[model samples]
Target chain A: MMDPQRLKYTREHEWVGLESPGVALIGITDYAQDQLGDVVYLALPEPGGRVVRLQKFGEVESVKSVSDLFSPVNGEVLAVNQALRDHPELVNQDPLGEGWLLRVRLANATELNTLMSKAEYERFLHREGG
Target chain B: MPELLRTSLYDAHKKLGAKMVDFHGWEMPLHYPAGILAEHRAVRNACGLFDVSHMGRIALRGQGAAALLDLLFTGEIDDLPLGKARYGFLCNEKGGIIDDVVVLSLAPQAFLLVCNAASWDRALGWVQQWSPRFEPVEIVPGREETAMIALQGPAAAERLETLAPGLSTSLPPFAVTSEVVAGLLVTVARTGYTGEDGFEFILGAKEGPDLWRALLKEGAAPCGLGARDTLRLEAGFRLHGQDMDEDTTPLEAALGRFVRMEKVFVGVEALREQKRAGLSRRLVGFTLEGHDIPRAGYAVRAEGQEIGRVTSGTFSPTLQRGIGLAYAPPRHAEPGTRIIVDIRGRDAPGKVVALPFYRRKQGESSLASL
Candidate 1:
């Protein structure tokens, strides 16, 4: 589990890391992958696609069902994790590292303030009773 | 909300930290902490134990029992020898499948019908309605008093022999016998839904917890419905509600072999007529070329036109690929035929393949007699 202090989280279970000025990396949280079980496929948007905060960008499919992956902040997709096409299990094995879904050029750096801190996300998980 | 029914091993599942889900009103374990993937692999490579008590068990006893089943089911059940089982379907007069069942002929004038859990009430009612026609035959519902556990995989027989000595060795495929295990009476049947050698034990409901623990102690991994579904799908077994329904005929479901044409049974005339006219569509199996998963209700296409729909689809744990069964027009049902599945609006390419996406290597024990 990655320290929630270093990353911001969305209520829909995605995590965001501001890598540099105007750039961010995103992936689903450990809690999300644990709930989804073993992921078999991931459908992601192509590079150069624009996304808005809380917008549906792609989907993560487990053996049992599919869940929509929601964008946490507005951005232009710089690249998707192409390794996921052949090894979706990485989402279950290394959700914080190799399982990272996308790298993006943030449209608005201020959008990060609206997201929850690691402490707040832990409380949110507790409240959800998961 | 209505009360959700639970099986005898409900507490056992909870103790193992299994994730429970409601399956047709039955509160059952969907998977355990090891998850579906590991549970499925356990059943294929080693052995897994499943609590199958939710499935309906109906007992028929009387001089007219065999005769009544022969008329009601599509298979020739009257001549089924004692201690053996036969797989067949109960069809409506129109030849549409009501339920696919397995009947175990326990003795003369006595038999047991095991039907799907979801179809229990309807199947029992259908049997009761026909019971009067065959005088002296009694239709007894046994689910409340009985519990069942399926021990399945390549190592199943070896694991079973350690618990009930000589029981697994004495039984051949599709054979059933009553034995006393740990001072409890158990009806051991050499049968399973997964494409592997295994046995299903039917015993007193109260004894379920004890046997479940004993099996676990003997190294049998506790599995849940998630593993059961993937295993059955890989074996090319058709789930009743998904693969066929009251509106789908057995002929269209590609289960014609289970139907005996020489015998008089419900829907025989309709099946005979279907044979004469030829089926317009038939069930076919396919494997996706890539990682995209085909799911139930997904449209199947050929030549840019919608030809059919997927009945059951899943990522086969054993084959490590996407596989499914679908109903397609006869022209598109042949092996090697090209077809595309509409996965969330995108067309994913796949090709029709032979039934049973996985078969155990030669010299492995046969799982089913049929």
Candidate 2:
């Protein structure tokens, strides 16, 4: 888990970290990575592609099953983790730091307020009976 | 859902941090904390042990035992050499496979059978349906005393050699022998589903946990059904329910070599007739065009029209690619034929290839891949 005060999350379990003035770094939370054991492939959106809030942006395929990745807030894709194309295990090894999936420039910064904080996301997972 | 049945190793699996899942109404370990990919590598590169107690084990011993097995199974069980094992199928009268079984000739007029856990009940019912004709044959459907375990990989023989010296030298590959392992009398068979050379052991359930622990201490990695499925798939082994059902014949399933028309057995006539008439569709192995994974129930397309469906598929840990098995027309079954896998509305291009995406090299620990 990262520092509680700086990170924001979505109901779908993605985490967003403010990297610069309007840029954000995003990746799935630790809970998501554990639920999906052994990530194998990722079909990520291309750079400069516009993404809408709470909409499907890409897919993450594991050995067990495939899951849809939802954008936590509206943004334009700046970059994807190219290393993940060959080494998806990084997601399971470090979901918060090196395993970051995307670099997106924020479309609406207020959308971050709509997301859950670190403490709230933990409570949500607890309430889901996981 | 009804409560799932637990094996005797339920506690041991929990202690090892196994991810439990339902397999044919029984709770079994799908994978341990190491995950499926790592476990698969362990079996390919070294020794891996698996608890297969959920599989059905049936024994028959009497004057009528050979006669009983001869009429029910499709292979020549009576003439199966002593201390040898034969792979064959139990089929319905229409040549539909009921179960693929391993027949072990224990003694004169005595034999043992191991079958898939999913099809055991049906196999037992088939046995009961015919055993009455072969009177005086004792059938043991629930052999509560024996626990089954599979020790697979190249280093498998070395691990067992530590338990019983001269054990590997005495028995040939695909052969069986009885030896006391760690003070427990056990039957060890040089047979496994993985492409690697390995052994499957049958021992008393009471002492199973102790032996499991002993092997773990001997550096054998504990594996689960997740790796087992991938290993079998990589080796081009057919799954009972997934690959073939009562509606699919042996020839259509590409298991023609296992069928013996010279001998008398159930469904021999249909198989012979089909052999003469030729097959309508055949089981074929293939690899995906890219990293895309193909799953069961996905439509197989050729010439832009649906032809068949994928039976079993997975990301090959050994080959590092997507591979699958399907039934398609014989023309499309040939190698180098173009095909498409309709994966969730997106047509992923692929081609028909040979079975066994992976093979073990001679005297090598690693797998030889395409």
Candidate whose DockQ is highest = 1
Pairs that clash in candidate 1: none
Model 1 CA deviation exceeding 4 Å by range:
A19-22, A46-50, A78-86, A118-130, B363-368
State TM-scores per candidate: 0.95, 0.95
lDDT of each: 0.89, 0.86
Highest TM-score against the true fold, candidate: 2
Question: What DockQ would you assign to candidate 2?
Answer: 0.69
Q: How good is model 2 by TM-score?
A: 0.95
**Model 2 misplacement above 4 A:** A1-5, B363-370
Candidate 2: clashing pairs of residues: none
At residue B31, candidate 2 shows an lDDT of 89
Give one digit per residue, the lDDT tens place, for model 1 in B193-295.
9888888999999998888888898888999998899999998889999999888888898888889988899888998998999999999999998777888
Fraction of true contacts kept, per model?
0.67, 0.53
Stretch of 10 with least lDDT, candidate 1 chain B = B361-370
Give the per-residue lDDT digits (tens) of candidate 2, residues B40-145.
9999999999999888888988888889898877777766788988888999999999999888887788788999999999998888888888888888885456
Docking class of 2: medium
Who wins the lDDT comparison? 1
